[model samples]
Structure formats: C-alpha cells, structure tokens
Target: MTATRILLRAIALALLFLPLAGAAAASCGDPATPIARIQGAGDHSPMAGQTVTVEAILSQDSRHQGGFQGFYLQQADHQTDSDPRTSEALFVYTRRSLGEIGDRLRITGTVKEFHGLTELVGIKAMTRCGREPVPAPIVLTLPWPQPPETLENMRVRFEQPLTVIDSHNLGRYGELTLARTDQVNATEYLEPGPSAQLATERQRLQRVVLDDGHRQQQPRPVPWPPGGLTADNTVRAGDRFGQLVGVLDFRFGDWRLQPQATPELLPANPRQPPPARPEQPHLRLVTLNLANYFNGDGDGQGFPTSRGANSQADYEHQHQRLLAALRAPNPDILALTELENDGYGAASSVADLAEALGPSWCVVTTPGADGQDEIRTALLYRSDRVQTSGHAKRLTSGLFRHRGRPPVTQVFRAKNGDTGVRITALHLKSKSCRGATGADQDQQDGQGCYNDRRVRAAEAIVHWLSELPAPDNLAGTLVTGDLNAYAREAPLEVFRSAGFTSMVHQLQPCDARTCPQYTYRYKGARGSLDYALASGSLQPRILTAATWLLNADEPRALAYDGPLDVTSALPWRSSDHNPVITDIRL
Candidate 1:
C-alpha cells in the first residue's frame, strides 16, 4: 500500500478509539474524586476550594423562581460507599436547570461551602454520560441517633409521625415546626434548675422544621397541611403528620426538610368550642388578657393606634371577636388585662365592652386609682347579677408605681342577698427584656426575663389583699388576671407559700392525664400566663375551673389583623392568651 493510504487508515483508527478514551476518562474510576470524599465525615467538604471532577446522578432540580437557585446531585446507588458517617451527596449551585432527574453526568467544578452547605460552583465542564438510578432515601426519626450532618444533602423519609409543634412562622416563611411529640414549657413542669435546663435541651433535639423548598417570604398559598391555609382551615400546633419525604438540609441555624412530595396530615387537634358553663348554680368568673385591646382613640377617626389595631376596620373586628369570646362562657364578672388605659367614658374600651354585653353590665369604677401604664387591668360585672358593696381600691406603691399594672380590688354581693365576696384584678410585669435590669434580666434558667419583678408583684398582691378592709362575714377572696408567670415559676411559688391556691389546679392537678394546663404558647412551648387563685376560704367553694382552649391553640393567621378576610363570627383566636373560667359558690 502507498504511504498516503496508510496515513488515512491510521486517522480512521484514531477516530474509532477516541470515543473509547473519552469513556474511560468520564467513568471517574481514577483521578476524579468520589462525592463521599468531598463530603467528608465533618460538616464541610475536605476538598473545599479545589477544582475536581465528579460523576453523579441529578436527584432534584430546584433552579426555578423562588427556589434555592440550585439542584441536588447524589452518587448512584451502586457507586456510593458503605461508610455511613460520610454523605454521598452534594448541592450543585448551577443557577440553571442543566440536567433532568436520574441523569448520570460527569462535571468539573470548584467546591465551596456556602453558609454551612457544601456545594459545587463555577462549573468548567459538564457532560451527560448516561442514566443512573437515584439513591434510595434513608429513613430518619427525631432525636436523631447520629449527627444530621452525616446525612447532609441526602434524601430522607421520616419513620415516625411528627407533630406540628409551632405554626408561628407558617404565614411568614411557609414553614411548620415538627417534633416527636407535643412540647410543653420546661418551667411549666419543672422548677428553673439543672433539671429544667436538661429538659429544654432535650426538646431542642426532638424538633425540626419542614420548609416549603422556597426561599421567598410570605409564600402565597401556604404550602403544608394539604389544603391551602384559610380562616376556617388551619394547621394548629398540636396537629400531626406522617410519611414525610425530603432532603435533610441546614439553613438559618435550623435543620429542615425540603419536601420532595406532599406529606400526610393527621388532625390530632381540632378546633374546640368555648368551655361550657357548669350545670351547678354558682357565680362564674373569667380572667382574660385582652392582648392589647386598644380602641384607637375610641371613635371612628383614629387610625393606627399605639398597640392593638392598625386601622378602624381592624379595631372593629377585634371588638366583635372579643364580644363573642366574652359572651361564650356567660360569666357574671370579667377580670380583664391589657385594656386601654383610657378613662371610663362612654367611648372608653371598658365602657364600650360593658355596654356591648347588655344594659345591665356595669364597669367597676377606680376613679383616680388606675396606673400610669398604657394598659391596665379592669373589672366589669353584670349589675343585675351582682351588686357592688364598697369603693374600688388599687395598689400604686412599690413595683406597681412604674413597672407593674396596679392591682384593682372590689367587694361584690350577689343580688339574691348572699354574703359578699372580694375579687382583685391584677396583671404583673411581662417576660419582655426591653427595660429589664438587675435581678429582672433573664437568668438562663427555664424562666424568662423579669422573674424577680413578678415574684415581688405576687408578694405585694398577697399583702395588699390582707390589708384591705372586707365586709363582715365575707364569703371568700379571689385574685384573678394575667400573672405573667407559669405554674412552676417563682411567682406561683410565692402565692403557694401564702394561703392562696390555684382554682384550676384544685380540679385538674398537674398529675392528671393532660398534666400541666396551658393558656398560652410561645416559641413552640405551651404554658399558662393567666390564672384564678382563690384564698383558703374560697378553695373549697370552687366547683370547677377550666382554661378555655380558644386562643392559644389556634393559629395567629385567624386573628383580626391577620391575612384572612372577614367571615365567621367565631371567637377562635380572639386574643393571644386563652381565658381561664372558674365557678365559685359565693
């Protein structure tokens, strides 16, 4: 054969072998790195900042609008290593949907750690070699047996049912916190100490958030709980869900699940009606924190008041809801907190509420005794049911001069000629740390800020009640309103040290099946901030007491100012704290 003919034959042979060489390089059997090696046993990648080649299958495509601006890549099932400590997956920040799910591809990029997430960015080359089976998701449960970093960026399925522990962020972030079981406030059960600290830590391990896979704020059509969220359809904190399939991820200092498919919601907690009135013929009393019930200048003009409502429309909605809630229990007297400090005029919040109740409802006048705080505790009673005996008194000395709302006390006699009873309405300093100092700051125990102030207020209340002159043969003395303290807190201990007793605890002790009763929920834990404590004389006369599950268990999205429009007249979420209803034989 001629020289030119031989050269042409060699060229043809080289073309045939070119594909074979490319296949060998793309196999990632030799110089290229395994995904598990890059995602070492530690939180970050061992090959961080280094450009290297990797072969994997695309597991998730999330490069659409409102997505995480990336996709997930995981080692094929047959190719992943058996080392359970190391992750066999990574997040590829492509900023574009380059490949379909289950597409096996060879890629060259620099490894980067973005806010604790190991990702591959600045891609230099990418080639779709062939299709591969996506890795099967590993089952996981709360109180994880090992550090979740071991399964970082890998698909996972929850084995046990998860309870919705918190929906506070449901409207803002479209995320719901899920836990192994319902979480109660540590201080509500155990006194603030080493035991409480341990319990708080245990609660942290059992919880994880289920994110909607989007980074947008206030995502439209709140994603979880099957149906879109509405005033009627709500996902409460105690609801349960199962069959959660997602990728374990860490962002914003929380370990969350970016769901692969919709989870199944099991409604363990349903909306309940207000507590029914006891069948026994006894006087009924209710203590409720109005949650800053400011009437915005009381008329129709003032818009955006200091606290409660932002507009006249919002104020009207709040007023209507509060009326519905107060009328449900059919209480003869109301001990209310967080009412607007505006005076007892016809347009005042207290007067408006009392007038709305009926023609016989009357406000217990304090004259010049109300405190300087923007909000004060007020008392109202039905004139036809109970008659006021003496003047109303308030404690303005000591801590109440500035910090706490003054305690208002009054004596009332039943219209049927029964013996007189003394009742005091008081609201203590809140847990807010804004102006807290000295002994009032957070002690890092289960109890929040202002423990000292609350304890002092409790002592003052007990002393003030003792000093006040009472009618001869008084039936009993009852202290009621928002104490701003849980059952096991220092303030409650002070009251217990005295002769006072919790009426609710008398009927439903903490040892019962439901254990500690909660009237408020915060940061995912439930506890009571409102109470009805009776003196030694009144303890035995207490027929029954219950914390009406109206407000705390319901979602804030159903509130007057929330995203929902005007619809039902139900008093589901009239306020942040639920009302405590008690019946007494005066």
Candidate 2:
C-alpha cells in the first residue's frame, strides 16, 4: 500500500477504540499510547521519535495568519489516567490544517520534543471523533500551589487575588508580571550582594507572566485587566485582581498563562492625583526627569539629535505630557533631569518648557551647557514664589564630567525674602551595563552595572556642593534629581555620611533607614531612583515629601512613541520616572 493509504488506514483503525482512552487498547500501528505516559518521568518526552495515536480534545487553536501554527489538545475529563503527576495535554504541530476548540480529535504523529516542549510533528493524520465536554479547570493559587511542571499546558484557575507587581511589558508585549502582593525591589530594601541574592531568587519563584496569546509585535489595544489599558483607568505595578482563569504555558524561558479571556482586575493600587500642597504656606519643590523633550520646529525635519522626540509631532506629545507632570505638583521650584543640552536660545528645549509653564516660570540660565553631556540637569522656579539668588554652578571636576550629567546647583530665595534654599538638580551616571568594565560591570549584587561610577559621582557631588557658597538668608540645602542609584547603593550612603537626610525615607520609611517612595520600576521590582535629600540645616524644616505616582507606574507605550493613549495632559504616565515632591517651610 502507498504511504498516504497506510496513514489513512492507521487513522481509521485508531478511531475504532479511541473513546476507551483510559483503558489499554490497540486500534492503530504499535497500539495507542497515553499522552501522560509519553510525558512521563522527566522534562523530555519519552516517546520521542516514535509514531503513536492519542485521543484528546482540542482546547485552543494558536494559529492565525502569522502565528504559532499549532493547536493544543488536552485529555478529556472522562479519559484522564490515574497518574495525577502527569499532565494530560499535548501540542500537535499542524501548519496546513486547522481545528477548533472542543473538537474531539485523535492524532497519529511522531512524538517530538522541540525546545523543551513535548509536541507531535510529522503528523500522519488526525481524525475528528465529534465534540465532547472541555476538560474541567483545576483551581490553583498564586505564589503557586505546587511546582508548575506537572500543570504545563493544563487549564487552571486562580481565584486568589493577584497583585500587579510589574506591568513593564503590558504595552510592549501584552504581558503582566503578577504576584501574590506588590513586590519590592531587592536592592532598594536590602544590601547589594548576598542580601540581594536571596531577594532575587524569591522574586523568580513567585512570578508568572500573563501573555495575550498572540506573538505579533505592537498590538494596538493591549489585552489585560478586562478593559483595554487607558490613562485614567490604567493599571499599575501595585494593582490587584480577585480571580484569573487561563492555560498555564511555558515558553521562552518563562512560565506564562494564556488567558481564555481578559481577566477582570480590582484596582488595588489605582492611579493617584499629583502630590498635595503642603499643609502650611511653604515652598513645594518637585524633581522630574523630562524623558527627553526635543521640539523640531513643529515639523519632522530634524533627522537626528542626541536624544528625545523623533519628529515634531513626537516632540509635542512628549512635551505636553512632561509639562502636565511638571505642573501637577504645584511646585515652587521644579528641578529637572534629561532636558536637551541645546542652548538657552528661543528654540531651546528648556526655553520652550518654560514658555508652556506660563509667564511666571523662568529657567535659571547656566553660563553654557552643563559640560558636554547630551542632556543636562536644570532648575525652573515659579517667579511668583521664588527668584534666583545666585549664578548657577555646575560640577565639572572628577566623575561629573565624564560618567554623569554634571550637577546644576542654584540658590533660590522666596519672593517675599523670608528665606532661601539651595536646590541642587543632579542627573547622575546611569546604571546601564552597556560598555561597562571592571567594577562598573554587574557585581552580581542587585546594584547592576556602573555602581562604581555612580558611587564616585556621588562622592564628588557631596564635595562640590559642600564647598559652594549658600545664598544670603538660606535656611537649608536640598539635593534633588535622578541619582540613578537605588536607596541601598554607595551613592546614597555617601550622602548619608555627609549628613544629608533622604526625605523619601522620612516620608515613607522602609525600615530603620529612609527608603523613600519609589520613583522607578525595573525588572519586576519597584524602588526609588529619584530622591530628595536635604542637608542637616534643611532636614528638620521639611514638612512632608512624597513621590508623585505620575510616570513610573504607567505603561511605557503611553509615551510619545505610540499614538496618544491619554489626552487629559495630567501628570500620570508622563515620564519614565515619577516626580519627587517636597513641601518645605524654608
């Protein structure tokens, strides 16, 4: 007989006795094998390279125009074997043929293991034996009820509420890294090395990403939390939900749940308005990272600049969001990072920002660009509240010139002349690992790369700011901006040793130390990267301080790269870093 005829005859024989799947039976060549037995004992399929028939119900078709080209077949409810440790599901790779969920199908193919996934390929034939009831879902809990290895490809339900610990990829990949509760950044709360190791491991065992099932890039409407993600109704890392039901799938080095439908979430940590005004009539200061504000003359002509908006339209989008965030805190002094290094001319980035902030706001003019960095730190104060008291100074010595955005320090006095405060706006060497070497590379500690450079920059900053002359009537000094180092790192330690009190720790205490309100989220943990540190003279005067949850918690896709996902122009989701707001009597 021909190969096609033999395949057809084999499939015809398998259909005769497949309904008796729980019992041993021989209806096709070499008899039939149980899917659980094929997946027995280890991570690899034991029946690999052998042809066999298995009866299953098609649970989902993961095939589209440009898709996975396969369908998931799971053992029916009535046909499951006695072995509870073995999963009852299998993946059948069929590029040309299609099947629907609930279709009872017996497939005859050669078992194969591709990239750790047990699947059937070289499919000879598939026989539809009519539909049966879908397998009943097994109930489970977060922090995992058991090792998920046995539950691979099986439908499960999570009735326990899961918190949104990390939504970094919600917009990019339609993924949600959820946990039993909001997770903490290890380095933020613990020391860098051995202490962080334990935290990192704990984070790993507790995470499971929820994927949208499609592998395509940039889906217009992100699928999650029942409703599409929006600016006002957005989900953050600390949000929570009551229940989630989906198929547990492992792929690309992570365990993901492909939800049958969108999971409805109860907003545990919802979008918050900007920081409130200080109790008394005092100065409110805000530190923000502009997220690269570059305007290209209202057109897309400028092909490339160092960093920022790609076109004029892109610039407007970035600008509007940034302006909204900057103004939301109702700050008297706005200390900023990541402003374009373009000069203070009419078309300058900082100049345009001042223009949008209304007539009373003014940018403190530097003698020239703050060193040669592509972006510089700046100070913008409301003229109605505070006025520049002295010429701005930039740290040009040591690590500031090469590895960091030079710190910009300017003394500002209240318009009524009650007192003055030295606001030092700093943008430090980033913690990125690109091109790093020696002590700069990841020390394995949770500090990541460039911890050394950031440390040196911090030390230099302390020395430089200490020597500067404080303006007359100055009550205290405040250091604010992106330190680019976490709370437990060497940089903050240097500031601590120099008698600077971290207001973040003061307002929101993590432990004995001041672990400020987190302004940044990375790799599934939330912690502070921006801070407001006050000198001893100013520390006692600080009334209240907090991180305005406008940026870091929001999805990255809401930024200028995509179409305007939000239109209200509020501070929420304006930049990658949340603004640090401090209300001080000084």
Task: Identify the leading candidate in terms of lDDT.
Answer: 1
- Alpha-carbon runs more than 4 Å astray in model 2: 1-31, 64-67, 77-85, 95-100, 231-233, 297-301, 401-403, 511-516, 563-570
Candidate 2's displacement at residue 474, Å, is: 2.8
Would you estimate the TM-scores of all the predictions?
0.92, 0.90
Model 2 clashing residue pairs (backbone):
504-516, 505-514, 550-573
- List all candidate RMSDs to the true structure: 5.2, 5.4
Specify the poorest-scoring 10-residue window by lDDT in model 2: 21-30
Q: How close is candidate 1 to the true structure, as a TM-score?
A: 0.92
State, as a TM-score between 0 and 1, how close model 2 is to the true structure.
0.90
Per-residue C-alpha lDDT of model 2 across residues 170-260, encoded as one tens digit per residue: 7777888887776677777787888788877888788888788877766657776566776655777777766577778777777888777
**Cα lDDT tens digits for candidate 1, 1-586:** 9999999999986764442212234453333577898889898887888877888888877787899988888988888888989998888888655688888878888889989988989887777867778789989888887788888888889999898878888878888888888888787778888888898888877788999989999777877667878777788878998889878888887888888888989998887765666776678888899988988767775678888888888888898899999998888989999999989988888988888889999999887678788899999998888988878899988878765689999887778656777889989888899988899899988777998889888898888788888788698898898888878899999988888888786677662125445689888888788888888887877886788878887777778887665446678888999999988876
